[model samples]
Target: FAGIGDPERFFRSLRAGGIDVARTRPFADHHMFSREEIAALAADALREQLTLVTTEKDLARLRGSEGVPDDIVPFAVELEFDEPAKLRQLISDHLYKARERRFNTR
Candidate 1:
């Protein structure tokens, strides 16, 4: 189950990680799942003997919500850049220019 901006991307990531996704339930980005909905998902997973996995963002949203299964796992992903130094320099330059503009405006 996934409630994110690009659930298909998440599914793809799972597949890339060699996880065999037998089924999926996707909701709109940032969808606020109701207790009943969570319960239903839990029931389905339990009945199917499948594990529940979701993205970290969705896990944060569902955190502290009642009926959330204890075994539900949150998948965390990291971004790898081909040119780390170049990306860092670009970001630094952008931030420096933005700061200069802000001060100039002030």
Candidate 2:
């Protein structure tokens, strides 16, 4: 999961649905993240051996900026059906295709 307006609601919904997602990164809505913030986040993700990602909304905010380093990865979260299982599968498929597209280019 990514930038959520309400963390409690998110957790509650997950609990109600019995979904077991391991990690969640939340950002302030339309957050203007600094270079230091991006670096720290990238370092933490690397330290944990986890994929580093961000939302398209956050990416849009960062556009026309020069401070962001090249290593950070931007991830976009798309909304589909409200059903949990369906949403999970859709996101998984999207990520897989996105990853393939990203890595296949030279």
Clashes of each: 0, 0
Q: In model 2, which range of ten residues has the least summed lDDT?
A: 69-78
User: Which RMSD does model 2 reach against the true structure?
Assistant: 14.2
Q: Which stretches of candidate 1 lie over 4 Å from their true place?
A: none
Candidate 2 local lDDT, residue 20 = 52
Q: Estimate each model's TM-score.
A: 0.89, 0.46
In model 2, the Cα lDDT at residue 87 comes to: 78
Per-residue accuracy of model 1 over 1-106 as CA lDDT, tens digit each: 8998989999999999989999989999989999999999889989999999999998898899887888998888899999999999999999999999999997
- What would the per-residue lDDT of candidate 2 be over residues 1-106, giving only the tens digit for each residue? 3454764555455545565545666666555677787777667777887665445556666666776655545543355666999878989999999999999996
Among these predicted structures, which one has the highest TM-score? Answer: 1
Clashing pairs in 1: none
Name model 2 segments beyond 4 Å from true: 1-22, 79-106
